[model samples]
Target: MASTVADVAKMIDHSLLRPELTNEDVRAGCDLAARYAVASVCVKPCDVALAATRLDGTGVSTGTVIGFPHGSSSARIKAAEARTAVSDGARELDMVLNIGRLRGGDDEAVLDDIRAVVEAAPGTVVKVIFENAYLSDAEKIRACRLSEQAGVAYVKTSTGFAPGGATLADIRLMRANVSERVKVKAAGGVRTLDVLLEMSAAGAARFGATATAAILDDLSGRLARTGVATVRGDLSTDRRMGPDR
Candidate 1:
């Protein structure tokens, strides 16, 4: 059976990933998330505090990145960043995998690195980003399996920084590799309703998008599930860059 439009909307991760964003941007983004009850406000580590402060009473929680668009930082540094983010009110972490290490064929190094971040930010949902556009089919499969072995909560596609973002084939690949415990998020290049719905049907439990209104524009009706998106009914304003980085 096909999913409802609401089901599709709940999967979106309303984005605010720009580096030039100001505190006002962060505040507006968090406010939107709270108003719409988005899945999580994925933000910069520094802005984690700002997002958290605004969404305190609301059910929404703050999310931050580690290793970010480029996951070159040492395991130690990444772990430290995760710890600080958690302490600063981040309930979720969109940590980028050390893609270079995975591509370099140092699979163990990558797993160990994920373990380190896991250790640093225990109890927080860890969505490991594979940046799918950068990897070949085999590398993507390998990364998904690694995220499973590491016991991450979600295996995400593109950081949205690379040339391409989420693709349906990639979402299926991710779903194929991981066990039931690990969920999949299809990010990047997911603007059109067709692409978003395709991803959801392919097994994406989450979506990261900057073109939220466009997605919502195509959608019509209430969703059964709630999410942390910044889009609200009868509202039209720019969104804070949260996860499209």
Candidate 2:
């Protein structure tokens, strides 16, 4: 299928979760997401309020992580974090699952941990990050089942702080295991328009990316060359470039 610039833009959740980013960086990221009209801006917990305020009325959502990088936080703490994040205007929450507990075969503990956050925010979208880098194929499948059972909105691949990120194979596996109600989000190392298309073909509905600008720019150029009309109801105006740029 031929994807327009808007289709590619909506797939991206512009990631601003790097540890060293300052408030200024967060604001800049929010601006970029708004300019391109990407799906949302995923920021650090402390930056959620800032991002929400900046992105208000821009049609882009504000999202943050809970028990990020490592999913070792207690269930109570994670639940509290979820409540606080929602209160701070976050519409989406991407939380890491307790890898240790999952690996140790404590399925109930893992399921409860996910449910704690889901229960915290009733209507908000909750994505359970599996951190697939450290998990075996069996473990990954089990995590997908647990996420589905917990009633999360999406099953995410990684935190971007891990050794590896989303792979086409992992996404396909996750999609195959989860029910239609549970969507798949591919994060970490999804840097190009080609990769985004590949993931989408593999049944991924969303993506986490730090290279939103480059990907969108590339998509725009491609669309201009093909003279394809932009997708329905997208805000971006078409830019028809000559052969020489």
Candidate 3:
């Protein structure tokens, strides 16, 4: 589990990928990320340059999504998108692998699809979102294996647009399946501090969250109240959240 405020702060990739968000919203989101000193702002593709510029010197990186909610785009298009995003100052790319192909048992196609993006952005952090809501356990395991084979940096749980999101079981499964080099990221429904701490303990190293301020604020409050310099979830730290508030 994260031990300090900064440890939890840095684990979040502040999300600005909502479809209806305007440029102003993206700018504000980037500003928030910078103020919080979070890991990065995962903005829309069009906002990559703007985020990069706004977040410049803030130590927060700029990231964008590819193939997004649905991973149906052709390899060529996804690769093109990756190259364009990188050129526009995106240092991280969260890409959805071709869900249909993976479900269809087309391993080679899946690998090629992922490789296209990874190779396109040479040094950028490439995270593969499985959209696990649509896949069975077998498919999820297969995706974990293929993602490892494709040499992606992180294997992510959801795109936050799916019917279901990250669960502890999936986090554990992913962590167990992938080698130690590949980290697990949990997105969707991780809007609270307790949930984030639970997922972190389960195995996730990163999170994609739109509720950045709330989560961090809760952590800061907990630290202040307990007078603890650091915290561990498994140590039975005060459960700020209960069945009833």
Across residues 1-245, which tens digit of lDDT does each residue of candidate 1 receive?
44444445566677778899999988987777666555767888889888888889887768888998899999999999999998999998988999889999999999988888988988999999998778999998989888888879999998988988888788888999999899998888877666665577688888887776666655542221234343343222222312222
Candidates' C-alpha lDDT = 0.79, 0.90, 0.92
Best by TM-score: 3
TM-score of 1: 0.86
In model 2, which runs have C-alpha deviations exceeding 4 angstroms? 230-245
lDDT by residue (tens digit), candidate 2, 29-137: 9999999999999999999999999999999999999999799999999999999999999999999999999999999999999999999999999999999999999
Highest-scoring model, lDDT = 3
**Model 1: residue 120 alpha-carbon error in angstroms:** 0.9
Q: By how many angstroms RMSD does model 3 differ from the true structure?
A: 1.7
Candidate number that wins on lDDT, 2 or 3:
3
What is the C-alpha local distance difference test score of candidate 3? 0.92
Model 3 residue runs over 4 Å out of place are 233-237, 240-245
Q: After superposition, how far is residue 187 of candidate 2 from its true place, in Å?
A: 0.7
The ten-residue window of minimal lDDT in model 2 covers 236-245
